[model samples]
Target: MEVLSLKVNGDTRCLAAAPQATLLEVLREELGLTGCKQGCDKGDCGACTVLLDGQPVLACLTLAALVQGREITTIEGLAPAHRRRCAESPCASKQDKLHPVQDAFDEAGALQCGFCQSGMILSATALLQRDDDPKRETIREALSGNLCRCTGYTQIIEAVERASDEHAGREHRPRAWEQPATEPAGEGES
Candidate 1:
């Protein structure tokens, strides 16, 4: 067993993992982050895709020990900051907005069986993070590794495009979290 230290979802995690354990195994079995699914464990299927140091890598094929010092982001890590806050406090509002990619997926009806949703969303988010205004072809290339048996690639591509637009729009305006606090509506204009 080897002690592995990894930064996941903006937190540091240390755990003992088998030397040969893949990142997927450590994430699901050890850390209990099961958003990455196991399918065709040989890495042909993108079911176990995750971001390692801002690059998308197949978790099932990635050695847990090899990725110890890098930042790993899973599907759960893609949730909005508000959602995480709400999850931590019962009094927090539950009406938090979904991540742009997730919102696009929902609006486009991109997922069917939903097995590939996490991987697709993560891949698209990574791509958008790097290039907020990627062309459709670039999106196709970015998502080429992920395979969705349920919805094919039509709506999936559309979702990515929609997300790109949403991301671009946000770039033009400050998000609520980034903006300064505002007074009550009735008193602001006085």
Candidate 2:
């Protein structure tokens, strides 16, 4: 076992792991950060997604040894990071403690089984960090690597949009289903 120094969230963690141990194993087993799920154990599924230096990566496919001295952000770190940021602002409320993307996911009903939540949320967070107002297609492209069997991608997209809108201080828009249906044009109308 080799000792690795990893900076996760905002704290530095030192642990011993095998040279071939994946980041998922070390984060979950050694550091007790189970937010990074072990889904496919391969790169096909994004269930093990984690932010490596503000970018989403497949933790199950990343070598723990290779990630030494890099910034790793797990789902568990989202809220704390947000809280630290919120300390400077007046938006730190008890009910609003979760990261905007996380809260938006919950509010938008973007999670079902929750197996893909961590990855989805992390991906969305990364996207929003770069693009504050991403279009639907952009959002879809950004999250293409992460797959969700439950939400059908609609709510997930909406959650990302909602988070962006909120971050931009835009007025909240009703969901597609919540919007009133338009009347069909009458025969007399051209």
> What TM-score would each prediction reach against the true structure?
0.82, 0.84
Across residues 57-144, which tens digit of lDDT does each residue of candidate 1 receive? 9999999999877989998888855687776775654335467688788878998899998999999989999998776678879999
Q: What's the lDDT for all of these models? A: 0.84, 0.89
lDDT score of residue 15 within candidate 2: 93
Tens digits of lDDT, candidate 2, 1-190: 9999999988999999999999999999999999999989989889999999999999999999999889999999998865756765775565546888988998899988989999999999999999998877789899999888774688888999999999999986744434445877674645
Find the candidate with the highest TM-score and give its number: 2
